[model samples]
Target: MTLWNRLLLGLILLSSCWLGLAVTPSPVATKPNVIIIMADDLDSRQLSCYGGKNLKTTHIDALANEGLKFNHIYASEAMCVPTRASLFTGLYPVRHGSFQNHKPVYDTLKSVGHYLADLGYRVGLTGKDHSTKPKTVFPFEIVTGFEPNCVAPTDDYQLNDVRKFITRTNQPYCLFVMSINPHTPWTVGDTTEFDADKLILPANWIDTPVTRRQFVKYLAEVRRLDEQVGEITRLLKETGQDKNTIVVFLGEQGAQFPGAKWNLWDVGQKSSMVVKWPGTVKARTETDALVQYEDITPTLVDIAGGKPIAGLDGKSFLPVLLGKSSTARPYAYGIHNNIPEGNPYPIRSIRDTRYKLILNLTPDEEYYNRFMMNAKQKDRNSVWFSWIDQAPNDPNAKRITDRVVKRPAIEFYDTQKDPWELTNLATDPTHQNRIRQYRQKLETWMKQQGDAGAALDIVYAKKKE
Candidate 1:
């Protein structure tokens, strides 16, 4: 047969298959490569695209420019393990049995690894494995080299390991490039880049030498993280995988500063999420849709052309990603179980775009985190001590410091009016009805999840490997 005739026959066959004259499947690839680059101890509000004026995150801003940014995404639990556990499995910490810090996910539970693997994806994770163990629930090929702290200089050599994985893999890949940036012992990034005297501190932060010094280091780490992200994106482009990959950059939980990481307030629970899926997701778009870490697994499952597992706590936010839906959930929930790292102070919270309700289960016990509480340690910064010393003269500092150490049983804040949550509205007569509704909703959810609240905190023991 002639070459032209053979080409014409192939076209005819393809058209016939599409028209149902034949039974051949479509030739186009349906599975997409997925990459989630998560930055540890990073805050969404500190990003340039998120109204952050102090630091210029050029690379992260570039991702936001090329993808969709989610404004109200949250971590199910504020700390690393719980939030990461929830992210891996489409279940809250209570249901997954990994709510406590440094605890493993229940042996019988299934995670994203099992779900995506079923659809023929080669899943791998690199840098910071804070999620639960037993390795059965979350099985991943570990990529090497970007495994150190997040403040380390962004080196092109570190990405060589990830580059090999993306270029060598033919089957769909789900790569998690988790960076431990801006975490405590923040001494790896460029300190000279940020001027401690000129940086803008958080409204709730006490203005002291120690506070400024630590924050300056934290911001520098964040900048380093941004450069690392740029390198990954560039790798995808060079490898010709950018078009077929869905790249998601997430600010896992929030920074480790007071009222952020270990608490259940907005700063602690909220995370910054930006997703780029060339043709599938719209670029340069923003949404205020409420999404939680729990929703991530189901969303990935759905996007990977697989059935979402039944009985999962999270539903897929695919519609929101596609710009077909303006909202994902009516409310986002948060939980904080302080044990193994601090005093046993359990907290549960719920928010619906505006108001936030926080229930401190062990309000009578003064809040304490041994690591943060110790300011005189050689490696530790003295922000905590400075705050305590300046409390008498600075009213705002005193108020913030007191709130961090002490708590009431019921706390409510109008997040729309006070984004920082400086004022408690639980006692306001006008907000009584809304407060009651949220409180009841949270209690009902706790009951459904079989969460014993304060009892869970009391019984939490460090898991044995």
Candidate 2:
């Protein structure tokens, strides 16, 4: 062969080798690791990252600074069992049918953990597992990827279980860390020490002497919860999985206080949501887009490059997190129900960016008075109760208490003007047109979703007097 032909042949071979290297798939990025950290009965207002001042949550704040923070996030329901069930199934409480805290509904639907395991990703749940009955078969029968380790209803053993799993796992995995901290019974000393005086009361809540005192205790509990979160994040870093894993931190429901946990108010359904996806999400980008707890499953599925289950009530926010602008949810729905011996059947609400409308199906005075009555029994000495009990004698207290207790069948609040929802505009003639519009929207949604409330006789028999 000629020298020129030999040189041409050598150059062509080199070019072919470079093209092959460029076209190869780069290992597919290994199905990113996922970690969901859930706090029980935590309020968004209690987190420093969410404009809270009572406790310092430096670790969570750091995570928020590194990723996306959702301002208008909501829970599926204002109660534990239902909210967690919705998170797993990407459905509503009525559809999943886990109506109360003691009722476990994992058997009725597939869990996100199980789906991930089926797709070859290791999955495990540590800490509180409130989905299944104490001895009922969990959705994931064999722990296909990682062993199941959960905290006892009254014990803190799950923390160690989570640490062990992270340390031992050798494959890409998903870990659901459910913390029992910050739930009711307000005890101190489990995780961190905090002073009561540091707590800040919400503007809507009465700033009476009693309310201030209760806030102190509540603030301490929030700080302790923050420490637990810090410990978990530190473990991720220690295991060297912090950068590769996407961490989602949020609350299961609102605080377990009056008009908070078992009510449809913002305090009951609003949650603190922070997502940290090291390379994907932007640093400290905050969006007020409405997001529901059910959206969590779909979001994770998108991140894993897996197809979402059909008939899901959630939409993925993957585009928004990837720095895409002009992404937003139209509206968010919330439900409140099934407190032990609590009066009234149930309530539902829908909120857009500017306004919130609530429908009280069983709007009886007796039912609305149940929470106030319970407060008197649980904490007679509590400043909150003392102020309410003395309302008749104190004109100022009466003015505040009466307005909340005598709320109407339909309630409306211009969220932009009254974010705290202390004032009700349901009866005001000025908001009549707005009320009709929202009521129609709520009705259309209820009918389309086939809400059990529509077929109460078949789904939920009326109670005897």
Q: TM-score of model 2 relative to the true fold?
A: 0.84
lDDT values, one for every candidate: 0.86, 0.71
lDDT computed for candidate 1: 0.86
Model 1: which residue pairs collide?
150-180, 150-181
TM-score per prediction, in order, is 0.92, 0.84
The collision pairs in model 2 are 196-216, 210-383
Model 1 misplaced regions, further than 4 Å: 1-26, 148-157, 375-379, 459-464
Best candidate according to TM-score = 1
Tens-digit lDDT track of model 2 for 139-188? 43222222123222332433555666665656778877677766655555
Model 1 weakest 10-residue run by lDDT: 148-157
Q: Per-residue lDDT tens digits of candidate 1, residues 1-465?
A: 999999998999899878889656689765899999998988778899899988888888888898999999999898888888888998999999878777778889889888999999988888887673678878888788676434344422387788888888588999998888867667667889988999888887889998898888889888888988898999999998989999999998888887788888888888899999999788899999999999999999999888869999999999999989999999998888887778789999999888899999888889987667765572465778889889999888789999999999999998889999988988999999998889889999999999988888865555566
